[model samples]
Every structure is written in C-alpha cells, then in structure tokens.
Target: MTVALVTGATQGLGLALVEGLAQRLDPTDTVYLTGRDMNRVMTAVESMPGGGAEVRGELLDVADHQAAQRLAQQIRERHGGIDIVFGNAVMRVGPDDDPRVIADQYTEVNNFGTTRLLRAFAPLLRDNGRLLVVASSLGTLHHLAPVLHDRFTTPSSLDEIDEQIARWRDELKDRRTGAWPAFVNIPSKIGQVAAVRVLAAERREDDLHRGILIASVCPGMINTPTSALWWNVSTAPTPAQAAVALLDLALDPVKPEHHGELVRFGEVVPFS
Candidate 1:
C-alpha cells in the first residue's frame, strides 16, 4: 500500500490535505493524521465520515526535534519508510494581528519548524517517493535572494539575483498565494518562496540521502484562522481544493526535473 504521512494534519491546509489524500489514496492505504494538539487531531479524525477509522491522528509538534524525530523513527519501525511525505506542518507567528510577535514566532514555527520537520522526516521518506512541504508564496527564494543575500551569509551573483526576481514574480503571477489564496494569503505576503529555496538548497541533499523526490509547494493564500478574510473575499477555494493540487504534485513519481523545485498545480516555478 502507498502509505502517506502528513505532519500538522489537524486544521486548515493540513487538515484539507489529510482529507484529500484519504479520498485519493486506496481505501486500504494507511494515512497518518498528525498535529501538535491531541484534541484537534482527534476531532479532525472524527469528522472524516466513514474514513475516520482509517484516519488516525497522532500528537506531534513538528518543531520538537526529539519528539518529531522519535515519531519519524516509529513510522520507520511500524510502516517501514513513508511512501509519501508532506511537510505541511507550519507555524505562522502572526497574520498581521500583531507585527511585534511576528518575528520570534514566525521564525520559530515557519523557519525553524520547517528545518526541523524536514530533518526528522528525511529518513522516513522512501526511494522514488515524493515529499512536499506546504509553504507560502512569500517564502519563495526569488523574493529573498537579493534582500537576504547578505544576511543569509550567502554570496550573491547577478544571474542569481535576476533569477530570483524573475522567478519570484512569475511564481506570484498565478495568484497572491501561489496555490491556496486564502489561509496563508498574506498582504505583502511572507517570504514562503524564499524559505522553500533555502530548504531546497539545504535539505535537497538531505532528502536525496533517503531517495526522496522533495519539493516545496505554495498552497496559495488559504483563509484560515490567521488571515485577512474581510479585506479579500472573492472566489476563495477551500482547503479541500488546495489539497487536491498539492497531492497531485506530491504523488507524481517523476524525476528530479522538478525535484527541490517549488510547484503549484503540477507546474514548476523557479525559486533557486
């Protein structure tokens, strides 16, 4: 069976991903629903209609290295290696609610949490298996390559800078958020594209060690508990809609042509 593991599977895009995957994957396939909150996890599983029995939620804070690492190890022991891994767990410190809390909190959940989850789940990924991280358009490297060049401690090249700009704008053209357009749709948007590029550079090799086809994905701006819903309320797709596209990218057994790339709706947009 093609087993899938998605961290932060309780609410918003993560919850949508779990539900969508359960529908797409075979009935007998194992789908693990994970989140930091047990109550949220349990509640999410219970709401899955007939599939609740097949859907099981585990308590996991992907940011907690030891705990998350242990969970990954347990998956290896119980289910061998994961066939599909979705690094969908994220921590957005602020959604403009309080800009002051944004820095530390954003770094903790969005940045540090991303690295930690990728590190923990790297070994759980199977050869030729696809892994997708639920990232934001703001995190695209194209946006930050120039602004953060010096701060990131990476030397910059003109080609790299031009590429970053072109790619960033191209990736942004699809919508405010690359894929979701609601939950994570940040005004001035967070640099999800940038984060994905960073992760691809640092974690691509890390993922390759496990034979995983990894790519970071922008789910667009999904309107969740942490977004500006009132300001922009047009044709907003649900988490379920976003999940469908994300699953398509994550399940494709293609080559590294798009590996370590940022994709949305089966299309690849340059980030690095």
Candidate 2:
C-alpha cells in the first residue's frame, strides 16, 4: 500500500494538504497526519470531512531529532518505505520575543529540524519517492545577507552550508544587530533549499539505484495563525489556495529538471 506522510499536519497549510492528499489517495493507501501534539493530531484526523479511513495521525515534533529517528524506524518496519513526504512543519517567532530566544527557536525548528527529518527519512524513501519542503517567499535570498544570499543561491557543499548555519547561530547569540532580527527565517529556509539541492545532487552522483525527487517550494503569503502574527493576515491568501500549489507539487508527475528547484506560485524560480 502506498504511504504518504505530512509533517505539522494539525492545522493551516498542513491540514489542508492532508485533506487534499487523502481525498486523492486510493482506498488502500494511507496518509499520515503528524504534529507535536497528540490532541491536535487526533482532532485533525477526526475532523476531516467524510472521515477518511486512509488518514491516520501520529505525534511528530520536527525539532525533536530522536522523535524523527524513532518515527523513521517505525515507518521503515511497518511500511518498508514511504512514497511521499511533505515536510510542512515550520515555526515563526515574533512579537514579545527576545532576539536571541526567537532566533534560536526559529533556527532549531525551521533549519536544523527540517534537515534532521530529511536525513532520518532518506533511507526510508522508496524508489521514485518525492519530498516537498514547505518553504516561504519571506525566506528568499534578498531577505538574507549578501554572502549568505550568494551561498544559498549559487549552491555550495553541505559542509559550507553547515558553516553558514553556524555563523548565523553565532551572530544571533552574540546579539549582533542589523540582519539578525530582521531576517530571522531566511537562514533556515535557505539552508533547507540548499539541502534539497544537495540531496538531489547526491542522488544523481550515486550509482543509479532509486529515483528520489527532492524539491522546496514557497507557498506565498498564506493566512494562518502563524502568518497572522507575523504579517498582515488580512491580505494573505487562504490556506486552501496556498495548499493547492503544494498539493500539485506533491501529486504531480516528477520532472527531473524541477528537482532541487524552489517553486513559487507553481513555477520554478531562480534561487536568488
């Protein structure tokens, strides 16, 4: 049976994705909805219209590396491998927030957390597996410092990307002003996009075994509790509208040229 997993599926864009994906999957297929809170997970599963039997719920906190590993093991044992993975989990820290604290949590959850999940699940992706990382336009290169913008857009070795992340963390910890607080989400999102490129390249360089497509996409400004706090929620697109593009990426036929690229408004755009 085909198995698909959606991280941070409790509400907003993630929840919309789960519903859209569940409706399309075959009766025998399973779509797992995951979040950090079990109550939310259960509630989301129960609330889906028509009560999708194929949809299930699990507790997953992307920031918790051990939990990711454990969940990966469970999926490996139970399903052998997964067909699709929508890395929809994300965090935004703003308002009444300490620069250091918000920066730390944002980096931990958005950048490190995503990469950790990818590493944990890479082995468990079956041939031709697809991964879609839910990214944001706010994380664009122009939002980053010049050097970092170059690194992210031009594509660099994973080690170099790690160095950049370390530098960012240090800058935040040292309380360096200017770029630190203004562009909090850029580093992690940039790292995630870079990670997608790295993964795609690795798959290409390795001996032809299985075809795994890795890609990151920015769903534009979506109206969600998270975005409401960060931006003018009134002007943002509905979660359903944003989710359509994401769902299209998740379900569409894989195109090799599109692999490792960042999609915006359903089109491939320059990383910069």
Candidate 3:
C-alpha cells in the first residue's frame, strides 16, 4: 500500500493536502495526517468526508527532536517504510513578534524542523518515494544576500546548510549587522529550499536512479488564516487550490528536469 505522511496537517494547506491525497490515492492507501497537537489532529481526521478511514492522525512537533525520531521509528515499525513525505510544518514570525523569539522560533521550526523530518524519514522512504518540502516564493534565492544565496544554492552537504542557518540566525540577533525581524521567515525558507536542493543532488546517483524524487515546492500566496494574519488580504487561492498543486507534485511521475528544482505554480522554477 502507498503510505503517505503530511506534517502540520491540522489546518490550512496541510489539512487540505490530507483530503486531496485521500481522494487521489488508491482506496486502500493510507495517509498519515500529523500536527503538533493531538486534539486538532483527531478533530481534523473526524471531520474528513469519509470519517478518515483512509487517514490517521499522528502527533508530530517537527521542532522536537525526540518526537520526530519517535514518529519516524513508529512509522518504520508499523508500515515498513514511507512512500511520500510532505514536510509542511512551519512557524510564522510576524513584524510584531520579538526579534530574539522570532530568530529562535523561525529557525527552529522552519529551518531545522524541515531538516529533521527529511533526515529522519529519508531512510524510511522506499524506492520510488517522493520528498517535498513546502517553501515560499519570498524565500527564493534572489531574496537573499549574494553570499547567503550562493551558500544555499551550492551547499556541499546538509551540514553546510545547517551552518548557514546558524550563521544567519546569529546575524539576525546581532544589532550591528543583522536582518530585520520582519524577514525572519525568508532565511528559514531559504535554508529549507537550499537543504532540499543539496539533498536532491546528494541522493541523485543512488536514490534518484532508484526512482526517489526530492524537491522543494512553493504553494503561492495561499489565502489561509496565517496569510490573513500576516499580510493584506488579496485574491489568493484557497488552501484547497494550493493543495492541488502540492498533491500533484507528490503523486505525479517525476521528471528529470523537476528534480532538485523549486516547483512554483506547478512548474519548475530556477533555484536562483
């Protein structure tokens, strides 16, 4: 059976992804809907159209190392391996949030949280499995300083990417030479996209040849609660619309040109 996992799926695009996957995947396939809160996960599962027979809520807090590892172990022991992994969990640091707290939370959840999922579940991904991390267009490489962009796009390894995140966070917290609090999400998202690119490149010879596809995806300016809270409302697509694009990436046959690329609006975009 095709076993899929979607993290931070209690609401917004993540929740919509669960429904979309259920509708498209084989009837017997299982979709693991996960969130940091069990109450929300259970409520989401209960509200699905089929009462979620094909979906099960799994609690996961991407920033919690032990929680992530435990979930990975549980999935490995229960299902043998994972076929599709959607790293959808994220933390939004707005302009009003404290700079120190913003640096701490955004880096921990958006940057490290995504890496945690990839590192832990990557091993459990069966041949032909797909890994997609949710990124934002604002986080594109061009949005970063040249040096930072270069570091992200051409990282030698995942460790290098992590180091870059650490350095960026340090700068963010620095008064003399630091980033603005409003732009906290950009670095974290950039780090995520870069890490995915590095991983896709690193695993290409062995994993890609064996049918594994790893890449980062941008869902566009989705009209969710998170968006409304942070930015001016616009004619952005609903969470369901964004989910359609993400589910397509998750289930469609992988194209060589799409591997290691940032997929935005359902097309492969230049990483830089």
Candidate 4:
C-alpha cells in the first residue's frame, strides 16, 4: 500500500495537491493531509471527494521541529516508511509587511521549516520513494546577489543553511539588510531550494542506488489566497491547474537528472 503525506494541505495549492493525489493513487493507497489546526485538517479531508484513495488528516505546524520529528516517527512506525512526501507548507510576506516580522516568519516557516521536514522525513523515504519540495521560479540563484551564490550552493550541511538564515534575520532586525534581496521571499525561497540541493547531493549515491528521487519544484504563478496576498492572481492558473505539474513530478517515473534540481512543468530549471 502506497502511503503519502502533504504538509500544510488545508487549502490553496496544498489542498489541490491532496485532491489530485487522492484521485490518482489507488483505492488502497493512503494520503495524509496536514495543517496547523485539527479542525481545518479534518474539514479539508471531509470536503474531499470520496471513493478515491483513503484520505486522513493530522495537525502539523511545519515550523515546529519536535512536531515534525514526532509525525515522522509515527508514520515510520505505522507504515514502515512513506512512499512520497510533498513539502508544501510555506509563508508569503507582503510588500506592506514589516521587514523585521517578515524576517522571522519567512525564515521560520519557509526556510527552516523546509529543513525540519527534510531532517524528519527524508531518512524514512522507502526505496523508489519521492520527496518534492514546493519552491518557486523566483528561487533561482540569479535572484540573489553574486556574493551570496557560493554560500547557498555549496553549503556543507543543513546547519549551514540555518546559520545563513539566522544571519539574514539578524541583519534585518539590526536594519543592516543591504546585502539581501529587497523582498524577503526571494531569499526565503532560495534557502528552501538550497536546502533541497544540499540534501540531494549528500544522499546522491544512496538515492540513486535505492531508486529514490528528491527535488524542488516551482508550480508557476497560481491563483490562491496566498498569491492574492502578494500578487495579481486574476490571470494566474487556478490551484487545481497549477497542481497538475506538481502532481506529475510527484507521481511520474523517477528521473535521476531531476534529482537535486529545481523543476517546473517537468523540466529542470537552472539554479543559477
């Protein structure tokens, strides 16, 4: 029986991803959807169409390290290991938001949250499993200043990424943020992609030999409440439409070349 998990799946693209997975996975397969609140998680699961895969809900605040670790252990014990994981939780900061607050929320939820998920769940990926992180095209290294590229791309450990995020947060708090991109999401997304790259490289041999694939993906611009918070979504694809590409990457045959890369519409996007 295939077991899959999607974090922050109460609504928007995450909800769409869960729905798509339910429809595609076999009836015996299980899909777990998570959100910060139990009510919202259960509500989302109840609202999904029935007679697909078995859909369940759980409370998961991706920013909580211990929470992620506990859930990972629970899944490992209950199902032996998971077949797929979609790291869909993220925080988006608006232009009007305070820089200091953005620094904290974005780094905690978007950057370090990704790290926590990777730490907790990556090791439990069964053979032929897949782990796909929801990043964005804006996450490209080119979006960051030239001086920061090497630091992001060549991180020796996940802790290095965490340290870099902490340094950026400190700079924002100290009002010494000249080196960072004007928008906090840029660096936040870059950090997420960087974490995925670091993990993929660190596990390259094992992943290849075991037929596992890990990747970061950009779903392109999508019309969702979160996008409405920051951009014009009138012309953007709907969440269900954007989900097609993400679900494709999650369910399609594992591609070794796509491992450790940022993908969009099934194509590898240059990190630089």
The sequence of per-residue lDDT tens digits that candidate 4 reaches over residues 1-272 is: 99999998999999999999999999999999998889999999999988779998988998886888999999988999999999999876666889886677778888889999999999999998999999998889888889888768767789998998888889988899877887887888888898999899999999989999999999999987767888899999999999998898888888889999999999999999
lDDT leader? 4
TM-score against native, each model: 0.75, 0.89, 0.93, 0.97
Weakest lDDT window of 10 consecutive positions for candidate 1? 180-189
Q: Considering only N, C-alpha and C atoms within 3 Å, which residue pairs clash in candidate 4?
A: none
Off by over 4 Å in 1: 51-53, 93-96, 145-147, 150-211, 229-231
Cα displacement (Å) at residue 110, model 1: 1.4
lDDT of each: 0.63, 0.77, 0.82, 0.89
lDDT (tens digit, per residue) of candidate 2 on 19-85:
9888877878889999999998999999888544399899999888588899989989888989889
Q: Name the candidate, 1 or 2, with the larger TM-score value.
A: 2
Segments of candidate 4 deviating more than 4 angstroms: none
lDDT (0-100) at residue 78 of candidate 1?
85
* Cα lDDT of model 3 by residue, 1-272, tens digit: 99999998999999999999888887788999999989999999997887332999989998897777899999999889999999999886555787665777778888888888878988898988998998987667677667555667657788888888888777767743433334667777778888888888878877768788888999988887668878765788899988888888888887777787789866887767
lDDT: which is higher, 2 or 3? 3
Worst 10 residues of 3 by lDDT: 175-184
Query: How far does residue 36 in candidate 1 sit from its true spot (Å)?
Result: 1.0
Ranking by lDDT: 4, 3, 2, 1
